[model samples]
Target: MTDLDAIPDDPSALRAALLAMRAELAAERALRRGLEDRNERLQHFIRQLQRMQFGRRSEALDPDQLNLALEDLEQAVAEADAEAEKADPPRREARARERRQNRGTLPGHLPRIEVVIEPPTTICPCCSGAMHIIGEDRSERLDVIPMRWQVIVTRRPKYGCRACGSAVVQAPAPPRLIEGGLPTERLVAHVLVAKYADHAPLYRQAQMLARQGIALDRSTLASWVGTAAAELKPLWRLLRDDLLGSAKLFVDETPAPVLDPGRGRTKTSWFWAIARDDRPWGGADPPAVVFTYAPGRGHAHAATLLKDFRGILQTDAYAAYKAVAGAAGDEAAAGSADGGVLLAHCWAHCRRRFYEVAQKRPAPIAHEALRRIAALYEIEAEIRGRPACERRAVRQARTKPLLDAMRPWLEQCRAQLSKKSPLGEAIGYPLNQWEGLTLFLDDGRIEIDSNVIERSMRPIALNRKNALFAGHDLGAENWAVLASLIETCKWHAVNPEAWLADVLARLVSGWPNRRLAELTPWAWKAEQDALHRAAA
Candidate 1:
């Protein structure tokens, strides 16, 4: 029945009916607004996905942009839910209870401040008698304390001997990373970590310091960095020597631009990365990477960098690497074959060529190649972390047949296409490096790709994007030294800032050169873990 027909004749009854209708209408309007908001959000999310999939390369969103979009959508959803809860009070309570139940506990390492909230009285109102507590509720929330800066003042009092008044004695001054500088070793380490690890340039850091009422120039920070790099150069050299001594290594290089004041422009330099990670095959050696800055990307540079190395070098099909291996082979021909460096090609590089072709247009051959490579990757994933002998055996049993068939199929496909075509070139990459590509089948220690070192180069790229270019060649070398140590610390899951502070303090306090090995990231991590265990 209609509202009018169902209404009572009395004025009071009619007024009550009108109020109920108004409340119902308000709730309906709130529900409609919530639905509309949700619909708009869903539409935006769909459009983003479609654009990501079908958009032009130049129009596509980068990782950070995509993350930002998702964050906004999440916030919008939260707002809508909050409005809905405001409209329905009972639903608000239910949702709050559910959220409390699902909430994770805070970390135990953080200090807690207790706040006891007691009732006005402990007596029972009905009985007028004292009541004892039976239980209590407790909850925790994360909190943060803003960073504060303070100056450390040092003073030394000199005393004169009573008999020999001319002779005064006092304790000698402590050495620092920057002698007679305002900052301590810990503060200098923070600047280095912020610049290299966090990719905060010195100028930005100086600006941040200025906000905190400290007036420091970017050049002052740069000087601190240069002095730290000089002090830590010995450690970097030790790390490089240690990595090169590994029986298997992954190597890659990326362009690093340096400002050339004479030409009034930046010149392209290179940062060559050498990485050793044996954890994949369950080897005990800790993972580490070292970057060396070179003025040029030439065969001579690669040869000189690896002159003292004598092991397997896993890398992409870069021409300079081939020349280095060839020279090593020629030198070893007169002696032992084991002395030569062997090269293992990266299959990811080969797959990338095909992927690029498929991305541009439909190519059944390229898709088939990708599918086959993906299957090989799946098998590799299953055998990862297994012993070397077991991994080699599994590859021989399962991976060898696939590789055997893939090579012949690739040859047939290449024959069907023009040599200048994209598909033809993609197929030719693997066929050309068949020997090195199959090197992993015999030695499980060698990976299917040099992606390890490639992954290590990304931080350098991020730093380049932020700073644009280094001031000069020496600046680039310093960048390499600091970046190598910081990246190695990350691999070992150690705090780069803490480790750097301690190491810098030790170095300045006359840490013996012979004990430099103990200052390495892996060594420091081991020592820290040992201490924690002992404490436990």
Candidate 2:
């Protein structure tokens, strides 16, 4: 009415009016958006609280009603405490086992029998004619010696022929487990086991050794692990080749410490694992499992480890893996491996993020996803230890539908939810890993999660937690080999201590090429079993 545009030459008044109106509009919109996001997140948390409080219902949960129950809150807190306890170093479990082991000795070459001795006869000298034996007296018990470390000196004698001025030479000495290295095969194995299996840190290991009267230092022990790893590189390569050649593999990664020689700081090392099967593929020949160490979480390392990998590669949805997938596609297109890399997504990994956010917002989508996945796992449980064909059939008939149903639901939730929210993040991360997640669905050979490899990685994680960061790169890589061997033995149901001792004895005997494969956990296990049967 006042012809404001024509009067807008008054810049101060125009600007102030525009700013005030814009501020009011922004405030109103911001208030509405904030409430929507809060409600969304809260809704997710409530749903989680309900699921934790009540036995899970097949029907979806309502976020609004979830807050009405304090029982859910109490139950979830208990669960969180339980998880925290689990996250702790498994030292208590190890302590229990150690106590059990201490209570009973193995059937060693030495006998564990105890003999009772009657006390010497006692009577007055004057009444010696009626001497009588006294009650048995207490005797000192025998004490077992602690573990002692000593260097074995192996000398090769030279020979010469006196006749015709002819000279004779003896065969050369075989390489030591560590050339010019002071540690014994047993010591190396002990250090490896302590670090990986026992999760004992190097410094702690040094202390343990000291108690055994061995004056070893952590720095020195670290070197032993590195050198031993170098010696085992060939075995790691062989394992990697075998894993890639397999038709199915379950793979995962966890963080590792790598000392940067130049920077003097520990860099992040991801332990990448490729395993064929976890719960016994139950085939005549077991699938191979391999582990590799890389400094960066990049595709190049994966590309190298899987250079000839034409078979199914099961893994989680890490972006680095996608690059690997892209590279594998290129390789396949170029007829490199001659087969394509199939993707398998881990429903557990996908469910876990949602579960985490569900702590804040118990969203139905997360709980429902977990329920659906649980059903698939239940089917797997029902078909436990079944052959691939049988498992595939069961999964196809039952589990496939759950997967099919999950995809559309994920898509709808992704669309309906705010992109910025944690629910979106939780859903998107696994969805991104979708390529790997969906791999098992396409093929029966694939598994639900990359747990096979992840299980193998647990020992490493346990060891890392105890030992802390590795002292050096070589030490970390060495750990990878030892872990590969130990984990592989475990996977094949082989006793690690036995397999390790046997392999160490053989390898230190010059790593017999004709019998090197037998040094592998899987191979050595068979040999050990065969010998046991023969002796029996």
Candidate 3:
């Protein structure tokens, strides 16, 4: 270290002093650079948080319904607090309190419990007269009893033939999902819904059961889930087959980690989501999604899963999908052969690449591209509910010209920007996948993006975030099976718990395989609604 006071005020003396402390100065500069880099990362993280909490969710810039709901709840809470303050004045608030007492009406369907409070004396205070009841103040309070366990005792008397003495008669036990297991169909369904739908892990669920004096081990719950998955797999298979049979399908994949016992860590697995939703294009087929778990994210797995298909496949620019397309041979590229799958890439994915670049830097080129793409979505919003033919004609007339103009603009920008840069990569994406990206121009039934299947992956993402990882590959497969049905039930706006309960009961009661289609979410919802109407 060189002291400034000891150094002379001459150029040569200062130069000599600087030379002596160059190593320390260099280290100080290096430390400053490191701190600056860390500061940049922390700032970037803060921007991400701001965007997530306040930024527009979709490319369309549609208003968030969740925010609207939150506003309504806040207004309700404010009003409640105001009411509570006004009610503090005992003399002036009696009438207002009386009006507010029964403001909320409980449903007539719920059973009521009554508690009568009589006067302390049957005489009036002013007069010494015995009085009959004139009026009564009745206040109803809703009550709930937590889940209680009960033992179901089935008494089946046995009788023998008295005269013949050769025959024996006994009532047989009813068919159950678990033949000898104590849980009923509803109980098994409850466990399934709790784990897959509610995102409750088995160990946590076991503790919850223990709180109710039902001391079941986590392994027991896991066994029940495995058995239920095996039983319910037929329905899942039927759903997948039905979805694949459709003419158009949206496909996407998300990572799922499976525990590796040998390595004492987790291995990366994949959950491939295949969906068929024609309502967006005015087709008559019901919307359905099916998820399949695989040991790896490879083209062979996708090819095998889609081997029986001859339809348009919508997906992102994953090389695996392209490999699958190539392996099917060049002839099947058009999807006209007996077994072919045509690729239709997602525009949302293309926009997302540039959106990230634009968020990070002020890229005018990316913004321009986004503006042009937004115009196409504006046209889509206008003609959404129209017939497929009408939609096709509109896209050809309006959207085609913008896309034609965008291609050359993208190419010209790519020539000027670095090929490895984010903007340049975004420009190159559409150029490489041009045919697939523009598939919507030719077909009216195909969507502009594979957003439907991506939307279906959110539940899996949330569940994985909560549970961290599945116990094993088989456990992940079971997760896929149960999650498929539960998510499908949500897609059809059916209560998952109710659907699972009804489906499990039906299976235990010997639901025929031929009528398996009737057990699907849409069909089951119709049946339940019909039965409710009949009962009403």
Candidate 4:
């Protein structure tokens, strides 16, 4: 009943003070709620990282998950473009760019095996007179002569020795890849190049051969392939050793399914493609790719394949690669303690993760990340063929600053996003492998991504897609061997068919192992060109 109690009961003046106190309390509550929400997001981020890094990948987003919505959007865009095109015709330049009908001049080196298609009647009907020799309009169409089956009769003339009447003189027949087989080395090479390089299934090739009245069974062709693979393995080993000796290399692997007879189903194998291409940064080594088939995708496989290699190995952020790098300390794999292989991770893979998430959920953070990474690619496109020193300077000047800004920016995004979200999961990849991801910044000789090796795997993919799977483990090994040589020929811009044909002939003709480099696609090309010039 004092003045204080009376003041508490008062309405107007106390109300203003109470209102101010209530406003302050509401703000504190709002801030606390915000802190709690942020903490929840952070916890999700941590859980996502832990799950990805340690927990089963099945728990995380499936790396191979497809976004159907993206396909739908693309189809919709195409339809819209088609409608627009119908309304307004395409520009001349665009039409010209699209037109691929222009036939170019064939190579001058090809022999002119002419078959003059004369007219049915050379006489003029009006005059009933035979037309004299006149200028003829010549049009060229590429003609392929069906494979001619020939019997190479090697007649070794026998004679009685003059000094000794009982002795007989005879010449020995040449050694062949297939001792009693009817196929010539060139024929075997043709079959191999068709199956491996051209992605033709053996059955299809057998059918084609049967049309020529050869009637060779599919098993016969398969046996030839197997024997050829065995014969060519020494060359494959040499190529692999040479590739490993390169200072910088790109590495990748694609699934190669092998038929498991015991299980009555196909088992997954791997064709590990190790590639060396120093041309990007202007290194002298010619680009090459060698494929090794393994029964499993175990870390030991990578270890064995790269055991002798002691340089930069650019690859994707596959966990097995991490183990491979770790095992550099082991004497068995390392060759020597000082000969440890350096790891360089692919940025394309990092961009790919963010790209997938961006497609599903459009956000400013992901869009920004994509835009910044695109800028790095733009810089790479510009300086691709430049010398290493110049490339290094440009990267340091242009790419380095963007990368420097990107690190903190990514961290800030991580702080804002929940790690469990797709964007957060995408962001965690580059963050975890940041050191490997940024290895290119230090060495210009190293590429940003293992795309060279990836490009080399496409033929294998095509071959597998057509052939389904190899019949057995040895079949997969043969696939690897032939694919490696044929793909390497393709890498050097050599006609794979021509190279295989020539190499096979030389191999059967006793090409020395010490002079194996002469039969290599690049060297053989130079030698062929030189011979052509000398003939000219």
In order of appearance, the predictions have TM-scores of 0.72, 0.64, 0.70, 0.70
Residue 97, candidate 3: Cα error in Å is 61
The better candidate by lDDT, 1 or 3, is 1
Which one wins on lDDT? 1
Q: Once model 1 is optimally superposed onto the true structure by TM-score, how far is the C-alpha of residue 370 displaced, in angstroms?
A: 0.6
**Ranking 2 against 3 by TM-score, winner:** 3
lDDT against the true structure, per candidate, is: 0.78, 0.61, 0.72, 0.71
Q: What are the per-model numbers of colliding residue pairs?
A: 0, 18, 0, 1
lDDT of 2 at 468: 55
**In model 3, which runs have C-alpha deviations exceeding 4 angstroms?**
1-151, 158-170, 329-339
In model 1, where do residues sit more than 4 Å from their true spots? 1-146, 159-169, 336-338
Q: Please, what are the lDDT tens digits per residue for candidate 1 over residues 219-257?
A: 556656766776788999999999888898999999998
Model 4 poorest 10 in a row by lDDT? 64-73
The alpha-carbon root-mean-square deviation between model 1 and the true structure, to one decimal in Å, is 28.1
Candidate 3 lDDT, tens digit per residue, 1-536? 85658878899988987886897889789868866865674465344334434555431111232222222222223223233333344622453355345334434444554544443454434444444433333443322222645444344433444444444344354555544455656667777787778887666777887675556656555655666676688899999999878888888899998654344345799999999888877888889889999999988888878877767889999988877666655555555466566899999999999899999999999999899989989998898878899999999999999999999988899999998988889989999999999999999998898888988999899888767776545567778999999999998999887788778878757799999999999999898889899999
Q: What would the TM-score be for candidate 1 when compared with the true structure?
A: 0.72
lDDT of 4 by residue, 176-207 (tens): 55544456676777878888878877677767
